[model samples]
Target: MQAPGGAILEGFIDLLVEDGDGLRVVDYKTDQVALKEVDERFAGYRLQGAAYALLAAGVTGRPVTRVDFVFTDSGEVRSLAGAELAVQVAEIRTRLERAPGEEPSGGGDDQLRLPGLNGS
Candidate 1:
C-alpha cells in the first residue's frame, strides 16, 4: 500500500475490524513486556502500528483510526489513535524517505528485527 508520503508498505494484518466510521488494526504479539511497560516498551512498535494503519487505510480506502497491540505475555493492550497515530505514521514515512547515505538516529535502527539487517 502507498502511504500518505508515498512510502510503500506491506504486511499481513492479524485482524481488521470496522469501528463505526473508520477501521481499526489489531495485532497480536508475544513480546514479554510487563503490564506496566505496555505503552512505554511499545516505543518502536508505534512505527509498526502506524505502518499497519497506513497500509490498511491505503488498501481499503478507509480511515484507520486505531491500532491496538495485544501483548499476550502480559495480557495488556497498547492503543494508538487520533493525533498520536498520525504523528507515528508521518515519522515512518519520513524515515522511509531518508537519503540512503544518511545515518539513522536512536541507535541507528528502527528496532525491527530482520535477516542481516539492524543486527538481527
Candidate 2:
C-alpha cells in the first residue's frame, strides 16, 4: 500500500472483517496477561493496528474506523477508533518518512551492531 506521503507499506494483515459500518482490522496477540492489564500491555501494538487498518482500507476501498487487538491468552480485546486511530496512523507514517541517516532517539551503548554493517 502506498501511504499518502508516498511511503510504500507492505505486510499481511491477520484478518479483516467487513460489516455495515466499515472495515475492521483484527490482529491476534498471544501475550499472556490478565484482563485488567490488557490495555497497558497492548498499548505498544496501536501502531501495528493502525497499519493494518490502513492496509485494509486501501485494499477494500472502505474506511477503516476500527482496529482490534484480540488477546488469545486472556480472551481480551482492545480497540482504537476515532481521533485516537487517526493519530496512531499519522504517527506511523511520520516515522516511516524519517531520513535514512537519522538515528532513532535514545541511542546508547546497547545499540545493535549487525555483522558487516556500519563497520561492525
Each prediction's Cα lDDT score? 0.70, 0.67
**Candidate 2 weakest lDDT stretch, 10 residues:** 108-117
Evaluated at residue 26, the lDDT of candidate 1 is 89
RMSD for each of the candidates: 4.2, 6.4
- lDDT for model 1, please: 0.70
Residues 6-120, candidate 2: write the lDDT tens digits.
Answer: 4555556677888568988777777587888887767867776766777778877899988888899998888989999999878765655664333323211222221121222
Off by over 4 Å in 2: 100-120
Model 1 poorest 10 in a row by lDDT: 107-116
The TM-score values for the models, in the order shown, are: 0.75, 0.74
Best-matching candidate per lDDT = 1
